[model samples]
Target: MKLLLLTALTMAAFAANSVLNRAAVGEAGMDALAFGVIRLASGAAALAVIVAWQRRGFAMGGVGRFVAVAGLLAYIFGFSVAYRGLDAGLGALLLFGVVQVTMFGGAVMAREAVPLARWVGAAVALAGLVWLLWPRGAVKMPVGGAVAMCIAGLGWGVYSLQGRLESDATQATAMNFMLAAPVAAVVWFLWGAEGAVTGVGLALAVVSGVITSGLGYALWYAILPTLGAARAGVAQLSVPVIAMAGGMVFLGEPVTGRFVGAAVLVIAGVLISMLGAQVWAGRVGFTKSSSGS
Candidate 1:
């Protein structure tokens, strides 16, 4: 019972990131670059503190560390910038969709044995994304936001892939964030100077960094093993839905028929994919999967 509750809490925290990002970047007039930079720095600090409390030193040298840092930067900046033009729900969906595809593709490239259901599910999800991303479609999604979210998803996917090699998840993440912080600030200076950060914006960014992202991730890693791969993968399908509900309640975003249809298609597809491998393995839950939510 406690495990289930913790899992739910972790999922909510993950979804809250989208809501917080949208609120900060879209409504608070916070410059996206500033938000991204601050988030990275703050998250680094918070995670550093957590790691210290555990009496673990940071791992400063590894090729995987470098990749993790790079991927983290890309995801942070892309997510911040994308939210300036995207509703929380839409942004989450795009990010989620692309991330699944990227991870699935990576698995295929690595010669992982993918279940048939996963392949079909991936196809269905891709088709749904195509429907949503159609240039001249009924939904008329913003091209720039969609593209940025895709980049964010790809970055996150790569980060997750690299994370599998880590012996200590918290230490790896703390190190990655620490390494990425200064670089993120530089990037903000170069191209993220368009928007300004208000007090509310700063608060939102800090909470998102220190709470939703930093601590939330720690909590997730703590509970993830208990949930197992298949349950963990299936549980993430709820994030976009939670984000959508959060958008409606907190961000005043509307729910149109097109969005409803798209959501169903994408989420259903991912859920099927998650369960497919479990069923194929015959009683053993899926042990091969990526964790992005």
Candidate 2:
């Protein structure tokens, strides 16, 4: 139960990230590069405070940390810059699609066994995404932004996989954020000056870092051990749907029939992917005894 709640919260965090980033870049007119840097700095600051207050042990040199940091840099920069031409909903859909596909493909390449249900789930989710964001009636997408978002998604997928190798989620995440912040800052210095960060943009970026990306990531790392990749991926399928809904409510973006349908399919895919474990647990004698007594 605790793990499930954390999983839900983690998904909400991801959803909040999409919504908040959109607000900053789309609504506030902040350059993606500047917003990305500010977001990273804000998240690092928030995590640093938590680490200090908690006195968490953080030793900073390892290959895993380096990989994670690089991946984080790619994701942060790619994510921010990608939005220069991509719409929020479409960008998110493309991002997650690449993330999921790459991660799943990586697992396959590693000789990991994937169950039939998971494949079905992946298919359903992919099809749903296509339906939701394939540009209706000759609406042209910005090719450069689309490519950037795909690369960003791949970076994020690699990051997620790297997270699986760490022993301490909080320690690893803090280190990644702290180290990656400098790299992000450098990129910002080189590119961010072009777009001045407005007040609203700063606030949105900070909120994204402090609340959704920072603490949310801490919560995610805490839950990763218990949830594993399949469950984690399943839970994250909720993010795009939530972001679409948030876009409707907060940004006054219209929700189409295709979006609704995609939501259903993606959610169904998640449930199906987890069905085996859920069913097996239910069938185990311990579940009944524990519940009854």
Candidate 3:
């Protein structure tokens, strides 16, 4: 029960990233690179305080640290770049599709046993995503935006997998922010001035950093041990749905029929992929034991 709650909260946090990013960059006319740098810098500062209070020193000792840093860079850059051309909902769907593919592919590469049910679920979800985002009559896509969304998906998938390899979530998250901050700053220095950076932009970055990205991620790390990979992935699939709903309610974005259908498919697919195997294994064990008894 605790794990379920934690996972749900984590998904909400992740979902907010999309909504907030859209609001900041799309509505406010803020530069994406500036937002990314400010968001990450604020998060890094906040985490630094927390880690210092806890007496944790920075450490990047092994391959995990390298992977974490790389994942962070990809996620930050991919996120900022993707929004340049993609609409919020469409971007979310695209990113989710890429994320699902990346993580599942990672699992296969790691030689983790794949169940047939999961494969089917993945296919179902991918098909749903395609339906939701594919350009229809009159809805021509910005190719650059689509490309950015795919990159973001790949980056986030790597980040999620890297979290599993970290010995300490808080520590790793803090270090990643600290390490990535410099990179973000450099990128911003190169490109930030091109876009007018307003008070609204900085405020959005701060809010995202302090609330959604920083503390949210720390909490996610804390719960990862309890939830494991399958449950975690399934839980994250809720994020895009939540973000879409939030957009409708708060941002006044139009809710469409296709989005609803896509949400249903993604949610159902995630549940099947994550929970089916465990339930099947449990039933099999129970039957064998009962027959022996």
Candidate 4:
């Protein structure tokens, strides 16, 4: 139950990132690049303080750290770029679809044992996602924006895959932010729309960085090892649903019948992916024991 709650919280945090970006960059006229940079810097600062208290003194290292940092930077920048043109729902869909593919592919490459139920669940959830956010008539997609979201999805997938390798989730997340924050800030100052940064945007970015992103990511890292690859990928298929629901609740967006239906499908898929495998294993074990007896 605790793990379940933690996983749900992490997904909400992920969803909140989309909400914050929409509120700040999409509506408040905050430069996307500036929000991304501030988010990274603020997250880094918050985590650094935690690390200091732990007295870990920044021991992050090796190939895992390198991959983690690269993936983090890619996700942060690509997310900002994509959100500029894409609506919050569309952006979330693109980000998680690519993430599912990336992680499932990683599972294959690494020879991880993914159950059949998980694959079916992923497909069902993906179908629901497509149904919900596939865009209606006269909707024009900005190719660059869509492509940027794919990059963000890919980056997040890579980052998540590396998370299970970390010994200290907080310190590892801190180091990732610490290493990438400066680069993000540098790029922002060099070419970002400085004047476009608004006070509301700044506050949103800080909240996103310190709470949703910084702490959220730490919680995610802490849970990845326990989830395994296939389940983790399938689980994230819920983000778009969660994000859309967040919109209805916080942004006063009207929900439709379609939203309710799609939410059910997504939730059902998540349940099957997570629990079906365990049920199957249990049945198999029971049969083996009975035969032995």
TM-score of each: 0.76, 0.88, 0.86, 0.93
Residue range 1-293, candidate 3, lDDT tens digits: 46556777788887787688778887898888888888899999999899889987878748777776777778788877777666655776777777877877776676656677667666666666666666656655689888877877787778777776666788888988888888878877786358767788789889999789998888877775555454455457677678878889879989999989988897777666666666676777744311110
Clashing pairs in 3: none
Candidate 4: give its CA RMSD in angstroms.
3.4
Best-to-worst ranking by TM-score = 4, 2, 3, 1
Question: On residues 1-293, what C-alpha lDDT tens digit does candidate 4 reach at each position?
Answer: 57668888999998898788778876898887888889999999999999999898898688889899999989988987887788656777788888998988888887777778888889888888878887777766789999999999999999999997887899999999999999887777787455488999999999999999999999999998877777789888888788778878987889999888888888888887877777776877754311110
Which segments of candidate 4 are over 4 A away from where they belong? 87-89, 286-293
Model 2, position 18, has a per-residue lDDT of 82
Q: Which 10 residues in a row give candidate 2 its minimum summed lDDT? A: 284-293
How many Å off is the CA of 123 in candidate 2? 1.6
lDDT of 2 by residue, 1-293 (tens): 56666777788788888888778877888777887788888888888887877888777857878888888888887887787777765787788888887777766665555666667776776677667666656665699998989989888888877776777777777888889888888867776377868999999999988889888887777776555565566567678787878889999989788878888987777766656545544676445311110
TM-score of predicted structure 1: 0.76
How many clashes (backbone N, Cα, C below 3 Å) per candidate?
Answer: 0, 0, 0, 0
lDDT values for all models: 0.72, 0.76, 0.75, 0.85
Candidate number with greatest lDDT: 4
Winner on TM-score between 2 and 4 is 4
lDDT of 2 at 187: 69
Residue pairs with backbone overlap in model 2? none
